[model samples]
Target chain A: MSSILKKFLMALTGLALVGFLIAHLGGNLYLFLGRDHFDGYAKKLEEMGPLLILAEIVLAGLFLTHLFMALKLTGENQTARGAQGYADNSKNQSTPASRWMWITGLFVMMFLVVHIKMFKFGEREKPITAKGEEIIKAFNGEEAAKQFARESGEHGSLYGLVQKEFKRPAVVGFYVVLMLVLGAHLSHGIASAFQSLGVLRPGWLQCLKPWCVALAWLIALGFALLPVCTFFGIGIN
Target chain B: MNFTLNVWRQKNANDQGRFETYQAKNISPEASFLEMLDVVNNELEAEGKEPIAFDHDCREGICGACGMMISGRAHGPRAATTTCQLYMRNFQDGETLTLEPWRAKAFPLVRDLVVDRSAFDRIIQAGGFISVNTGNAADANALPVPKDNAELAMDAAACIGCGACVAACKNASAMLFVSAKVSHLALLPQGDAERVRRTLNMVKTMDEAGFGNCSNTGACEAECPKSISISNIARLNREYARAKLLS
Candidate 1:
């Protein structure tokens, strides 16, 4: 594919992923409503069965394609300079986030692997079905500590799993840092996607860069806060 | 002022070049950087040695012919100043400076400190012109161009195609140059007819010429003689993506 087309595909796939994050965040937010709401949300997602699997497959394709194209394009860009390189590279005018995109992207990609393993598609899912489900149910039943805790019964209790996982300081720290890296990647990527698709205007340039970066920060904050709040027992019974 | 000059010396395009150091003594502080080179070249000529062959025309900044790497930075250390506009006063009396050509795969080395920039001309040839023929000058206010757009077009049109953007880029990307040309025309009504074709063809030419993809490093903008905005690059991407989607 042409470089331009590759970039367009990246933008399309990236924006779609961002849309998925929004929905995922919304569903995750139901955790604050207690165990029944949280597990029910997960059940609804799994209940889609083939449709959910199809969506996951599409999501994986979009994600891998984005990574693949980004790597290829970055490699080509590096080769274009051949052996010639600037002696005073520090003089470049791009932002720090813009400059370190590949590094941050790589980090984010690594985090994504760990993330899917830990939460989405890793060994966490295996024990979830094999034995951990009952343990989670027991934890959810001990909600007598808080008066505001919803009376929830007969669910997988993902709320317990989340609460248990976040209580670990190391896990929460890793998540918070990962969210920041994800923020940096999204900050450049969002406005850049618009420019890649030819939708950005000069008038929008000033507004777009900061707003996009800010939006990335907001999303990061939203994600980052979850572990912090979980550690503080916001939704834990 | 007296200084040591480390000039890139390549006999021909195929010849491997290395820095040939020479002493430039008794140089005027106010002399342009090119003039200091001229003095050194005259001294070389007096001794029957080959004067350093570099590209320059219209010693002022506007012509776009004069360009070289002065101490690793394109044009010169001063931001928004062309090599021709750079003065010896900017350097210290005992300063040692290195001069090299704008290095890119697309820009083939012709000799010392001069690379064939006709690749740029070819890129311009691809779609830099409007096909529309305006018969004659109509009224003073004939074709209406919005004021802000007119100014922005002129801002983009200010690019002299000096290849500083190419020089500054770590990837050797020409997105800024291509975008400047595309945008200058795209923002105008006369440019409307060829907008799609122009962006597509120019980008194709740029890519085929072995230029790198833009990383939006803004190095080009930092070193540009005209200070062309990277936003133009964003516009170029925008235009290129639109063209690809349509045709």
Candidate 2:
């Protein structure tokens, strides 16, 4: 794809990921409302049928597009530098934002895999239970639930599995650390995506920085707290 | 005050390098980073040991000639400053300092901390100039460029050809440098004629030279002595697209 198209894809996918985060956090925050509440909410999502399937497909596409564009841009950047190292003379021309991007991006990607496995895949592997009871998840209908269950297991307790998994202190700690890294990555990435897309002006960029930072910290902390709270038995109040 | 220095040492470009620790005694807070290095070099010279060989041209901030990684940071602890302009006062006297050459696929070591950065010169040669011949253009003000465009172009032009961007960059990409040069000239009417050729050729040259792609990191701007804006890279992207599509 063209450079500009690649950049646009980068931004678009980034925005999609951000949207997913917001939704994911919203569902997760239900954890604070008590187990049955979260279980009920998850059950409703399960009932969404084709709509939920569509969203997952779209979400997967967005992730793939973003990753592909990032890899392409990185490859082009490597081509620009060629075989020689930049002279000391060019040192003054580099920026930490541009320099640390790939490293942070790689870390973020790794974190994403772990995150998806911990939550999405892990949810599939286990079943959802509220205070140790089978939650009636909506997710389309019994047929769709059966489909997911057949795919996952004879009877899927995704939510219960989520709770059990988060109950481990070590796992919770790892999740918290990864969340911090995600926050750092987004702290630069969000603003950077805007800059790359030409939508950010200097003055506005300055003004938006604190808010962006606040948002990143909130999401990271919010996700991180879920596992920690689960481990500590501090479920909602 | 005294400080511990971990400096990369190599006999030559072909030699394997190692870190050598040295002590700097009675260092002054007011000394520039290069000046501090000068003291160390002087001591080595006095001791009949070969002094560390590094590159430096204008000690002033204007020359993009001097740069080295300090404590894993391009141009030391300061932001938006060059090594020649970085003052020792910014550093703690007793702290240990790690110094090394800029590491990139394109820039290879010539000696201890000097790398051959001529790849940059090659990229520039590919298309860093306008094709206007024999001063055949209209009067200087005749083009009547927008004031904002002119200012932005100049801001991009402030890039001193220093490779701090490359060193600070994890991939060691030269997009910032290539983009700045392209944006600066492409914004002006005098450079309009060769704009398409310039972008395509320069980008091709940059790619052929082994530089990494731009990943939208701001590290280059942070370490830039001239404080060249990363916004220029975005502009170059637009220009490159236009060149590729329109031409």
Give the winner by DockQ.
1
* Tens digit per residue, CA lDDT, model 1, A1-237: 666777788789888888887787778788778876777788788889999989989989988998898888888887777675544456565678877888898998898887777676422211133234454566684534221233223234456667768889999999999999989888888887877776777768777778887878888888888898888877554
Total clashes in model 1, counting residue pairs 3 or more apart in sequence or in different chains:
1
| TM-score, chain A, candidate 1 | 0.84
A-chain TM-score of every model: 0.84, 0.78
In model 1, state the lDDT of residue B22.
Answer: 94
lDDT at position B189, candidate 1: 82
Off by over 4 Å in 1: A31-36, A122-156, A229-237, B2-6, B20-26, B43-51, B91-96, B137-139, B241-247
Give the range where candidate 2 chain A is weakest over 10 consecutive residues by summed lDDT: A127-136
What is the lDDT for B150 in model 1? 91
Count of steric clashes across candidates, in order: 1, 67
Please estimate how well model 1 matches the true structure, expressed as its whole-model Cα lDDT.
0.83
Interface RMSD of 2: 5.7
For model 2, residues B17-40, the per-residue Cα lDDT tens digits are: 788998888888988888888999
lDDT of every model, 2 decimals: 0.83, 0.76
